[model samples]
Target: MTDEELAISVSGLRKSYRDNQAVAGVDLAVRRGEVFALLGPNGAGKTTTVEILEGFRQRDGGDVSVLGVDPAKAGADWRKRIGIVLQGTGEFDELKVGEVVRHFARFYPNASDPAEVIERVGLSDKANSRTHTLSGGQKRRLDVALGIVNRPELLFLDEPTTGFDPAARREFWDLIRQLSHQGTTILLTTHYLDEAEALADRVGVINRGAMVAVSTPAELGGRHQATARVGWREDGQARFEQTDHPTDAVRRLSERFGGEVPELTVTRPTLEDIYLEMLGEKEEQQ
Candidate 1:
């Protein structure tokens, strides 16, 4: 598929289970070779939306397309071109790390080498170790290796780095970067705002089973030109003011200090701050 074609498309998507409406009138579009993030609180219908896109669940109403075909009608060839790393853990208690990877590799007609995939996820040293013996982070890496073993055109990562430590998280980000560089479209869902900022080309924020906004990380919540807080120590107490022109504020503070402002800091809204504000706004509207 060319870059212009949408890897995922949905319009007025809706899903309901019994009396509960899980997803409601959602619209989304994801471009090829882009890392798109879907973020929302628990029970916000994020899982249901993903499951529908993955063809694991049927939507109650609305149009949906994945790779130019309706997910519900897409066949095995369509399934082979997509990879999914679910939130649930894999069961390979009796198999060695390499053994499990190799086992899965055989299922795909064009799979990545098991050894290479293991190395890519930083599990070369644990290739011979039993899968059950690996740490939480290591096991997550194994899951990732299995997901990408087919070298799919599109990948769905659901809370991919849930149990990772700081170091492991960074390593996992590198792997994601590598996949993106290879022109693999990715759809990621995670609660980590920083992760979304670091990886997603575009992010869509969902709340109460509806998409609230969609934009690049910098543009989300009006963060690109949002007011910045400028602060400095004055009379042994810290004072701060929010302003759109932080440079001018700093210049004025510099004059007040005759040179340098004491403990001066110009802080812009971080991804987390902006995300929280967006969520708050959504709540108020509801």
Candidate 2:
């Protein structure tokens, strides 16, 4: 896609602290209206790159654009076009949920209604509760309510569901999908491979300050092309064969058995499997 169509664009992105390079010659592009997930282990420069994109930190070198404006040079008007939910829960313990949402709604000229935003994030019932009384997952919902209350064209989520239970995490994923369906471009950073698989249109992996790969969850690290494992019970033993075409292998196995292959199962490398392999290789090269 063209630069105009990208919500974020970075080329030769670099940053350093004293003698250590936290980010090194990284390149990335996130398309408008698409959910993009950035994956990396701790200290892999994911935070640094995202901070530069959010204009919260300055990069030592590289060209960066977010929402068609250079974030490093952005002003208040530019800021209104994007929203961010940081790793920490931005809370006012003394305020009610509705009151807090209303306060933040005033920051943007085109902000959505406080009540509606709260409801959209599934917080309507807790609107009158004190911030300090909410659960961990509720705090996260409140954070998202504030983030999208501005009706931002782009939203940044940093470990959005870190402390959420499984069910709450799934609910948050649905909310993310609703936002994307309404034309919001989302940039998400998460350690959960399943989260990326469920929410991202495309996922990018960064290792040791460089982008290792970028593709759909199923295709990352050539996962789609990777060999498949076909397993079955044979002659009182469990046996399996690794091949590119599992169907062909299964067909031969069935023919050999002259009937249904016993306990047949076909498996391919999962997203986590491919992700770990990428990180392992990157570490070895260093």
Each candidate structure's count of clashing pairs: 0, 0
Candidate 1 ranges with C-alpha deviation above 4 Å: 1-4
lDDT tens digits, residue span 1-286, model 2? 8887999999999999999999999999999999999999999999999999999999999999998899989999988989899887887898999999999998899999999999999999999999999999999999999889999999999999998899999999999999999999999999999999999999999988999899999899999899999999978999989999898998898899898999999999999999998999888888
Estimate, for each residue in 97-174, the C-alpha lDDT of model 1 and write its tens digit.
Answer: 999999999989999989999999999999999999999889998998999999999999999998789998998899
| Model 1 vs truth, CA RMSD | 1.5
Q: Which stretches of candidate 2 lie over 4 Å from their true place?
A: none
Looking at model 1, the pairs that clash are none
TM-scores for all candidates? 0.97, 0.96
CA lDDT scores, all candidates in order: 0.92, 0.94
